[model samples]
Target chain A: MPDRANDPTDALRRVDLVLRVHDHQIVGPEGELLGNVDDVELAEVDGRWLVTGLMVGPAALSQRLPGKLGTWTHAVWSRLHPDREPTPVVVPMEHVTDIGSAVALDEWAARRLARTLGLELWLREFVVSRIPGAKGGSSDERPGDLVESASSEATEAAEGGSESEAALRPRPDGRPVSGLLGRTGLSPDGERLGRLRDLWALGGPRDGHPEPLRVTHLEFTSHRLGAELGYSADDRQGPALVRAFFRWLHRNDRVVPISALTGIDDTGRTVTVETTHMRHPFDQ
Target chain B: MKKFFAIALGILTAIGGFVDIGDLVTNGLVGARFGLSLGWVVVLGVVGICVFAEMSGRVAAVSGRGTFDLIRERLGPRVGLTNLVASMAVTLLTFTAEIGGIALALQLATNVNPYLWIPVVGAAVWIVLWRVKFSVVENVFGLAGLALIVFAVALWQLGPDWSDLWRQASRPLVPHDESHTTYFYYAVALFGAAMTPYEVFFFSSGGVEEHWTAKDLGVMRANVFVGFPLGGILSFAIAGSAAVVFQSQGIQVDTLGQIGLPVGMAMGQLGLALVLLGFFAATFGAACETGLSVGYSISQYLGWQWGKYVEPLRAARFHTVLLLSTIVGVGTLLTTVDPIMLTEYSVVFSAVALPLTYFPILVVANDRTYMGRHANGRLANTLGTFYLVVVGVAAVAAIPLMIITRAGQ
Candidate 1:
C-alpha cells in the first residue's frame, strides 16, 4: 500500500463510522440498491482500529438490535439460512467506491455482490419471474442480467485479495463495530470515564484507491441516546427545539485519539485511555 | 407552452388526488354533525401537509432518498425499527380502509353487497399496481377524481346561506348540543384525514420514481401551494354540501351513499353519477397510493430496491410487499367490519402516528449534508417547527380523545 501516513490531508478527513456509515443503503453503480451496510467489520492492526469490510444480510443486521429482539432475529435468521451454520456476508472495504446518502459499490463489485442476496434471488426465481408482467417494466437490470456479466477475473481478485490479506495478518477474527459500541471506557488510573459511543475514522486515498478508513478517535458519552439521534455532530440541524434539547443532553460527550489508548480488553468490555488526551468532540 | 401544461397537469392531479377515503368520510361525518364549525382544522391540516410534503419532495429531489431511508439513517436501527413498525401499521390500516372504500363506492353504483365487491376490488387494485405504469395510475385516477368538483357545484346549487356557514366557520366553537371532547375529537380526525402520513411517503417515493431534480422544484412547489389548498377546498365543498342537505335533516353520514345524497338532492341524477365516479376514483387512487406506501416504507427502511420505475422482478421484495399488503387489506375488509368505521379509526390512528413520520422529514430537510445549498430556509424551518408541535399535540391527544368521545359517538 502507498504510504498514507505521509499524506498530511489524510488526517483531516474524518467520518463518524456508526453515524455516517453503518445502516446506510448500499447502491449499485447503476443506482439499483443491493442492500444496507447492516454492520461493519473492524480489525485491530498495529494498535490502530481499521474498518475492513461492510456486512450485509439479516444475520449481520440482527446483531445491531437490542435485548431479546436481537437474539430472536438472529435465531430466525439462522433457522432460515440454507447452511447448517452460516456466517454473515461481508463486502470488503476495497469494493466500496463512495459513501454519501447511500453506500455505493464499484460497478464490478456491485454486479458480483448483487448475486449474493439470497432472498432477492429466491423471490425473483420462484415468485416474481413467473408473474406475467414481471419482466415488462423499463428497468434494464433484470434478474440474471448482472450475474451473467460478472467476470471471473474480478471475482478471483476480490476473493484472493481478502484471503491473502487475512493470511498475512494471522490475527483474531475481525470484530464488528456493533460489538465494540457500549463497552465501558476507563482512564489509565482505572477511573470510569463513559461508555464508548462511536468511532471516528479518517478516510483518504492510498495506492490509487480509497484507503480502508482508519479509526482515529473514540467518542465516549454517559449515554448513547443523543449520539444515536445524531445530535453529537456539529451541524446545526433543525426544528430548533429538538436541536437545543439534544445538544443539551449530549453536553458531556468527549473524544480521544486512538493513540491515547493504553489497553483494550475485549472480554472485560473496557478500554483504558489517558484522560489528558480527551477533548470535547465538537472542539475540532 | 409544454412546460405550462405540465405544471397545470401536476397541479390538477395534486388537487384531485388529495381527497381520499379518509377525507371523504371525515369531512362528511364532521360536516353533518359539527357543521362548518371545524373548518379551520381543515385549513390548518392543509397548510401543515403543504409545508411537510414540499420538504419531503425537495429532499427526495436533492438527495434521491425516500422519507423512510432518512428515518432509518437519522433514528438508527432500534428506534428506526419502531418508527417503521408504527408508520407501516398506520399506512396498512389506511390501505385496508381505502380498499373498503372502493367496495363501498362500487356498492353504491351497482347495488351489490360491498362484501361481494371487496374481493373484486382487491384483485383490480392488485392488477393495476402490478401492470400499470406509475404515472398512468397517478394521472388517470387523479384527473378522474376531479369529478368530485360536483360537491362544489352541488353546494352552490343548494343555495345555502353562505353568510351563515361563514359565521360558524369564522366563530369556531362547540355547537350547543355537541360536547367539547366530541368537537375536538372530530377536529383531530379531520386534521389526520387532511395530512395522512402515507401522502408524504407516496409523494417522496413518487419523486424518486419520476427522477425529479432541482429543476422540478418549481413545479412541485406549484403543486403544493396551488393544488393541495384547492383540494382542501374540495374537502370543504364536501362538508358544505353535507351541511346544507344532511345537517338540516339530522342525518349523520354513516354510508358512502349517504355522503353522495347531498349531490343527488342538489343536482339530480347527473350530479349523483359524477359524485359516485369521483368516489370511485378517489378511493381507488388512494388505495393504490397507500398500498404502495406500505411497500415503500418497509423496502426503503430495509434498503431494498423499491419503485414502480423498475421491473417487478428486479425489486422482488417490494412487489412481494405490495402483493401481501393487498391480500391483508382485503382480508381485513372481509371481516365484515364497517368501512366507514374503519375510515374513521384509520384517520384517528393516523393522527396518533403523525409526529413519528413528520419529525424525521423536518430533521433531514434541515441537514446540509444531504441537501447542500437546498437545505431548508428560514420560512420553511419556522413552519416546519410550528407544525411539529402541532403534530405532536395531535398525536398525544388523539387516542385519549377517541376513548373519551367513544370515537365521536
Candidate 2:
C-alpha cells in the first residue's frame, strides 16, 4: 500500500462502530426513513476488514438484540418472514450517503436495489404501500416513478447479463469487515498502543480497479471516542482556533500507513502495525 | 407582474409568520413590567436575524444545502455535534412551548382546559406534518397569522400617550423597582424571542424544501429586509399594548389571556377574536416550524435526508423523530406547566444557544468553496462580524443573568 502521510480524503468512518449506530434511524434521499442499520456486511481483503453492505431488516435487528430477547425476536421475525433468510438484509455500501445521526441512502437507486431484496417487499406490504395516499396520490412527481423505471432497467440488464464477464474479472479476495472496529491495537512487542477509532482510505478508483476504494491508513486515538476529520492525517485548513484546539485535543492520535501494518488478527479486530513507520497525527 | 406578486406574497407571509409564542409571551411580559425599556433588544435581534437569515438563505439558494447540512463539513464533527445538541435542545424546548401555546390558543376558543387541548393539538400538528404539503402548511398558517395585525390596530386605538411611550422606549434603563440584572434578563429574553435559532434553521431549510435557487435570493432578501423589520414593528405593537394597559395597572402579564386583554379593551369582542385567531395561527405555525427544524438540524447533522416534501413513510426516521417530539411536547405540556412561563424560559435559553447556530452560518457564508461568488460580501461580513460579537456577549451573559434574576422573576 502507498504511504501518503498527508491524505485528506479519508473521512469515512469504520463500520464496526455499528454498535453505536444500531438503533439509529435510516433515511432516504427524500428524507424518509428507509430503516435502521441492523448490521453491516464486511468484506476482508489481505487480512483487512472493509464494509461491503448493511443488513437492515428484522433479521438484522435480532443480531443486535441480546440473549433470549434476540432469540425470541428472531423466532417471531422468522415466523412472520418464513421465507426470509436468517441472515441480515443486505444494502450495498454504495447506496449509503453518510453515517451521521442516520444512515442516509440514495432513495431512487436504493429503492430499486431494495425492491430486489426482501426488505422493501416486507416494508411495502406491511407498512407504506398500505397507507392512505401511499402509492401515488401524495405527489405529482412521485419517487415511486423513479423506482419503477429503475426496476425495469434492472430487468433489462438482468436479461442481458453475462456471468462469463464476471468470471473473467479478477475479484478482490476480501473478507467481511463487520464488527472489526473499536478494537485495541498492540505493537509487535505486546505493548498497548490505542483503540482503533477509524480506518482512512484512498477512496475512489485506484490503478483503474473497479473496486469502491482502498484502505490506506488506520487512525488510532488514545482518547475514548474517534477523532473528527480534523484529526485526519492531512486536514489542516479550517478556522485557526478550531484547528488549534482539535490539534491539541488529538495530539496523541497516530496515523499508521498501510505499509506499516504487520498483520491483523483472524477476527479482524486487533491490529498489529510496525511502530517504526508510524507518524504523529500532525506530522506533515 | 407575476414575479412581483410572488415577492409581495413572500414578504406578507414572512411578516405574518414572524411572531411566535416566544414573541407573544416575552414582549407582553416585558411590556407589562419593563414598559418598552427592553424594546431596543427586539430591534437588535431583528437586525441580527435578518443578517444571518439572509446569509443562510443565500447559502441554501446557492449551495442547495441547508446551513446544518454544511455545518459538519465546516465546523468538524465535535463542534458541529455541540452546535447540534445546543440548538436542538433549544429548538425542542421551543417546540414544546409552541405545542403548549397552541393548546392555550385552543383553550381560549373552547374554554376547555389547555391540558385537554394538548393531545388534540399534538395530533393536529402530527397530521399536518404527516400529510400536508410544505407550501400549503406554510402559506395557510403564514397568511392566517396576519390576523395578529389586530394587535397593532389595537395599539393605535388604545391611543396611549405617544410622547410617554416614546419616552419609555428612548430611555433604555431598568425601571426604578427592577434591578439591572432583571432588566438585562428580560432584554436577553426579548432578543432571544425575536431571533430564535429555529427561525433561521426553518428559513434556510424552508428554502431548501422549496428548492430555492440563486434567482430566489432577491425574493428571500425582500422577505428578510422588508417583512422581518415590519414584523419587528408588530412585536413592538404587542409590547406597546402591554405597556399601556398592563403596565399602568401594575398587573404583570402572565397568561395568553392577559397578553390579549389590551386588544379586547381596545377593539371590543370582534378585535379580540381576531387576535386570538392570530395567536392560534402564529403559535401553531411556529409549532410546525420548530418541529420541522428539530428534525432538519438532526438529519442535516448526521447527513440523513430530511424534509416534508417526501412522504412520511419515505422519511420515516424524520417522521419518527417528529412523532417522538410531538409525544414529548405533549408529555411536557401535560405536566400543566404554564405555557407562558415555558415560553419565557425557552427564549432566554435560546439566547444562550444563539452562538451555536450563528457561528457555522457565518463560517459557511464566508466559505468561497461552497458559496462561490455568492459568498458573504464586505457589507455582509462587516454586519456578520458585528453580530457575532454581540451574539457572543449575549450568549455568555444569558445564563448568568438568568440565574441572577431567577428567570426574570
Candidate 3:
C-alpha cells in the first residue's frame, strides 16, 4: 500500500494550521466519530517548533474559549476529573493518517482510544444502550484480519520508538496554539506591530515518514475580524463585494519568518521579532 | 425510473414540508389584518431562503460538514458559541411551538383540550425520532403534509375576486386602520417564517445525513428551486383564503381552527378534515425537523457525533441532546402558554437571529478550499449578497418593530 504520509500532495504543506486543522472533526479510519482538534500541542525540538500532538476534550477546548467561559469550563472539567491532576487527551501526531474534511486517525489507535471519551461512554452505558433499539444497524463487528494487521502495525510503530529516541524527543510543554494567538507582536525596538493572528506551517518528509508540520512563520494583523474568513489569501475568490471587504480589512496584516522571531514571552503575552524580515502577507 | 421517482419524491416532500406552524400562524394573522399587502415579504423571504439554503446544502455536499461546523470554523470559538446559543434558543423555541402546534391540531380534530395532548404529542415525536429511519420520517410526514393542497382548492372554491388580492399584493399599501409600524412588523414576521434558521440547519444537515455528493446536487437544486416555491404558493393560498374569509369581516386569526375556518366555510367538513390532516402533518414534520435541528446545531458546534443515520447508541451525545430538547419542549408546552402566541414570538425571534446563521454559510460557500470549482458563481453571489442585506435589515429591525407595534397588537 502506498504510504499516505509520504504522498507529495499532502494537505499540510504550506497551510495555515489554525485555519485548516484547528476545531476540525477527528474521525477513525472507517469514519467513526472521535472528537475534534480542540487544541494543538507545539514543542521546540532541535531548534525547530513542530506540532507534537492534537489535543481533544473539554480540558483542551476550555483554553481556546474566551475569558469567563474559559475559566468556568476549566473549573468544571477539573472538578469532574477522576485523577488528582487532569490533563487533556492528546493524540500523538504519528497516529494521524490524513487531514482533509476531518483529521483521520489510524484504525487500531482510534478504536482503542474512543473508549477514553468520558461523556460518550457514560451516556452509552447508562442511557442510550438501555433503549430497546439503540444497537440496531450498528456494524461494530470488523473482520479479524484487519484488526490483526492494524494492531501489529501499531505495535511496530510503538516499538520503533526506542529509549534513546525518547530521550532525544523534547517534552511537549503545555504551550498550545491558542496560547500564541492574540499575543501582541513587538519589534526588537519595543514597537508594537500587531496581534499574533495565525501561524503558517510547512510539512516535509523526514526520518522515513512525514514529519509533523513545523511552524515557519507568524502572522500579525491589526484587525482580527476576517482572520479565518479565507480572504487573506489572494487565490480566494468569491462574491466580489465580500471578498473586497475582507481584503481591505486584512490589508495591513504582515508575516514574519520564524528566523526573525527572537523570543515568545508567555508571561507577558508578547512575541518579539526582527522588523526587517516582516512583509505583507499577500506579497508573493 | 428510479431516479425520476426520487426527484419527484424530493420535490413533493419539499413542498409539503415547507409550511410549519410559523408560516401558518404568521400568514393567517397577516392575511386577516393586512390583507395580501405583505405578500411581497413572503416572496422576498422564499428567495432569500433559496439563495442561502442552496449554499448551505452545496457546502454540506462537497465539504461533508454541516452549517454549525463551518460557523465555528470560520467565526472561531467565541463568536461561534454566541451564535450557537442564539440559534439554538430560537430553534428550541420553534420546537416547543411545533409540539404545541401538534397538540392544537389534535384539539381541532378531537375537540379535546390541547393542554392534555401536549405530553402525548411530545412522546410520539420522541419515539418517531428514536425509532424511525431518517428517510421514512421525512417522507411520511412530508407526503402527508401534501394534504395541505386543500388550502389552494378551498381558495378556488371560495371564488374570491382574484384581482383584488392581486391589487393588494402588487400595491403593497398599508391599510388606513393599521399603522405602518404594525404593517412592517408583520412583514418581518412573514419573512422570518419563510426563512427560519432551522430550515437551513435541517436542510444542510439532512444533506449530510443522506451523504449527498456532487452527483446529487442536481436533485437537491430541483428540490429547492421547484419544491420550495410551490410550497411558497401553499403559504400564499393560506393567506388568500384567510383574507377572503376574515379580512372582510375584521376577525383576527388567533387560533389554528380559525386559520382553517375559511376552508371549512368554503368546502364544508371534508375540506376541514384535509386541512386538519395538513395541519397535523406539517407541524409534526416540522417538530421532527426542529428537534433534529436543535440536536444538529449543538452537536455540530461541539464536533460530537450527530445525525439519525448513525445508530442511536453510536451517537449517544447527539441523542441525549435530542432527548433533553424534547423534554424541555414538553415542559414549556405544559406551562399552558398559547401555541399561536409562542409561534408568533418564535418567528420574530427567528428574524432576530437570521444574520448570525446566514453570514457563515455565505463565507464558506465562497471558500475555494471547501467548494473548489463549485464555489459561488456571479449570479449566485449577486443573489446571495442582495439577500444578505435584506436579512440584515430584517434582523436589525425585527426587535424594535416588535416593541413599537406591541407584537403587532
Candidate 4:
C-alpha cells in the first residue's frame, strides 16, 4: 500500500508498482481511443518502469481490492463476457492520427470504441430511420458528424483550450453587420471607442434575419483593464466614471451608436466596435 | 428492440434525473401545505424543463458542447468566469443538499444520526462515479427510485374526498394561513427544484458522455418528455397523500417524517416502511445525480476529459473535484445544519440560478450554425422563449419573496 503520511508527491515518485495489459486502450477527448498502450507500470525509487502486470478482464481489476462487490463484479464480468479465444485487439501508437493538446486516435481505436460503445447497433437498428421524420436515410449524413458541429464544437473547444487550431477552421457563414455594433472604444480625441457585450436576440422565428445581435449595454463584470488590474473598482476613477456614464446611457434597453470598428477578431470572441462616443465631446 | 432500449435509456435518465432531494421534500411539503394548488408549478416546471432540456440536448447533440462551454464562448472570459462562479456555487449548494439527503435517508432507516452516515454516503457516491459503469450507475438508481411511486398507492388507499382535493389542485393558491409571500416563496422553490441547473448540466454532459448524435435526439426527447412527467406524477401523489391527511389536520411538513406522515397514517407500519424505502431510494438516487453533476460542471467547463467512461487515474482532475466536493458536502451536513433546510434553500437558489444556465441553452439552440436544420422550430421557440421569461421572473422574485415571507414561516 502507498504511504499517505509521507509527502504525496515524494511517495508518488517512490511508488514502484506498475501494470500493463495489451489492448488497454487510451481513450481521448471525444472517446477517441489512441491505440492500445502495450505497457503501463508506474516507476519507483530511482528509475524503473515496466508493463509489470497484464490487466485484461474485470477479474484483474478486482484483484486490486478483495471484497464481495469487487469479487462478484469481477466474477460476473468475466463470466457473461464473450471471448472466443481472445486474441487481444492490437493497434500500435504509431497509428495515432493527430496528437496535440488532444490526441486523435486513428480509425482503429475509434472503430473499436464505437463497437464497445454499442454505436454500430445503435446506428444500424435503433437510431437511424427511427425518428418520426428523419431525412434521406443515411445518404450524406456522416456518423462522426453526429457529434461534430462545424461552428460550435470547434469554437467551444478552442475557447477552453487554445485558439490557434480553431482559427484555421472555417468561419461561420454569417458575419456581424454594421448595425449590430454598439459602443466603440476610442482614444480621448473623439476617436472611435470599442464596442461592449453583444446582446444576442435569444429566440426568434425560424426564417427572416436569424436574430441580429445588437451590441447590448456594456457590462463590466471584472475591471481587467491593463493598468486597472491591481486597482479595485473603487480605486479607479476612469472605469467608475465610464461605468456611471454607461449606467446613464443604458437606463433602458436602447442602442447607442459610436464610430465604426477598425477591426474585429472572430477567433478571439471580441469585437473592436470602434465608436466616437468619446469620453470627451470637445476633443481634437 | 435496440430502438426501444435507447428510448428506455432516455426514460431511465429522466427518471434518475427527475426527483432530486429538493423535489422529494418540496413536492411533498407543498402537497401537504396547499395540496394540488402549488402542483401547477411542477406542471409549469415540467413544461419549462422540457423546453430547456430539449434545447440543451439539441445544443449538446448539434454543437458537441456543454453549458459552461457556450457560456464562456458567448459571455467572454470575465463574465463567463462570473457566471461560472455563480453557477458553480449554486450547483455545489445543490450538491451539498443532495449528499445531506442521502445521509438523512440512511438515518431514517437505521435510526443513526445522519451525520455519522455523511462520510459513508459521500465515499459511496464517489466510488460509484469512479468505478461503476455509467449506464449501471444511472439504471440502478433509476429503477430503484421507482420504488417511490408507492406514495401514489398510499394516497389512493387513504380514501378521502376526491372532489375537494381535485378542486384545490385545479385552483392552487396561497393558503389562507400562510401569507402570499410565503406561498410565492414555496412556488419559486418548487419551480427551481423542477428546473435545477444540474439537470441540464447532467443531461447535456450525459449526451456527450453517451456520445449522442442528432439521431439520438428522439430517444433523448422521449426521456425528457415521458420520464419527467412520470416523475411529476409521482411528486403529485406525494402531495395528494399529504393533502388528504395533513391539510385538514393542520399538520405542516418540517422534516422527512412529516412528509411521509400521510403514508404512515394510511397503512400503518407497512406504508411507513415503503415511504422510508422511497426516501432512501430517491435521496440516494439524487445524490448520484448531483454528485455526477459536480464533476460534470467542473470538467466540462475546463474541457478536462471527464465521465464515468474513463479510468480514475486518467481523469484525475475530474475525480479530484468529485472527491473534494463530496467531502465538503459531507462536512457541511456534519455541522449539524438541517439537511431539510438545506434542501429548501437549494430550491430557492435553484430558482435564482435558472436564467444563468437556461439562457445560454436557449441562445445556442436557436443558432443555425450549431443546430443546422435541427434548430428549434416556432413551437419550440415559443415555448422555450416564454419559459425563459417565466424563469427570469421566478429568479428575480425568488429572493425577495423568501425575505418577505421570512423563509416562508
Highest DockQ model number: 1
Relative to the true interface, what fraction of contacts does candidate 1 keep?
Answer: 0.58
Off by over 4 Å in 2: A1-109, A112-199, A203-211, A218-226, A229-244, A247-256, A263-284, B51-93, B106-123, B156-171, B266-270, B294-306, B316-335, B352-404
lDDT of 3 by residue, A1-284 (tens): 12334322234357677887888888887767788788888888788888877888888889989888999999998897554555677777777777665777776558655645667766766677776666633266432333344335444434654332232222446478898999999998899889998888887333325457788999999999879877775345677888888778888889999889899897999999998878988785
Evaluate model 3: give its lDDT: 0.85
Model 4 spans with C-alpha error above 4 angstroms? A1-189, A196-284, B268-270
Q: Mark the 10 consecutive residues where model 1 chain A has the least summed lDDT.
A: A162-171
Q: Candidate 1, DockQ to 2 decimals?
A: 0.40
Per-residue alpha-carbon lDDT of candidate 4 for residues B1-409, written as tens digits (9 for 90 to 100): 9888868866865664578788888987887777788978888998888888888887777656666666544443345556777887888888888888878777777999888888888888877765677777777777777767778888888887889888887876667887777788889999998899988988887787777788777888888889988888887888888878888888888888777777777778887777777677777767777778877776554445466665443344566677688888888888888988998998899899898888767655654433556766778777876887899899999989988888888
Model 3 spans > 4 angstroms off: A1-12, A136-171, A204-210
TM-score of candidate 3 against the unseen true structure? 0.93
DockQ of each candidate, alpha-carbon based: 0.40, 0.09, 0.39, 0.02
Ten residues in sequence with the least summed lDDT for candidate 2 chain B = B70-79
Candidate 2 residue lDDT tens string, A149-179: 5345545434544332122111244233334
> Tens-digit lDDT track for model 1 on B267-352?
99999899999999999999999999999999988889899998787788899999999999999989999989999999999999
User: At residue A109, what lDDT does model 3 achieve?
Assistant: 51
**lDDT-superior candidate, 1 or 2:** 1
Tens-digit lDDT track for model 3 on B94-153? Answer: 999999999999999998999899999999999999889899999999999999999999
Error of 4 at B201 (Å): 0.3
Q: Which candidate, 1 or 4, would have the higher DockQ against the true structure?
A: 1
DockQ of candidate 2, scored on C-alphas against the true complex (2 decimals): 0.09
Identify the runs in model 1 with alpha carbons over 4 angstroms from their true place: A1-12, A136-172, A204-209
Give one digit per residue, the lDDT tens place, for model 1 in A118-179.
67766766777777766733456664553333323234434545442232121256888888
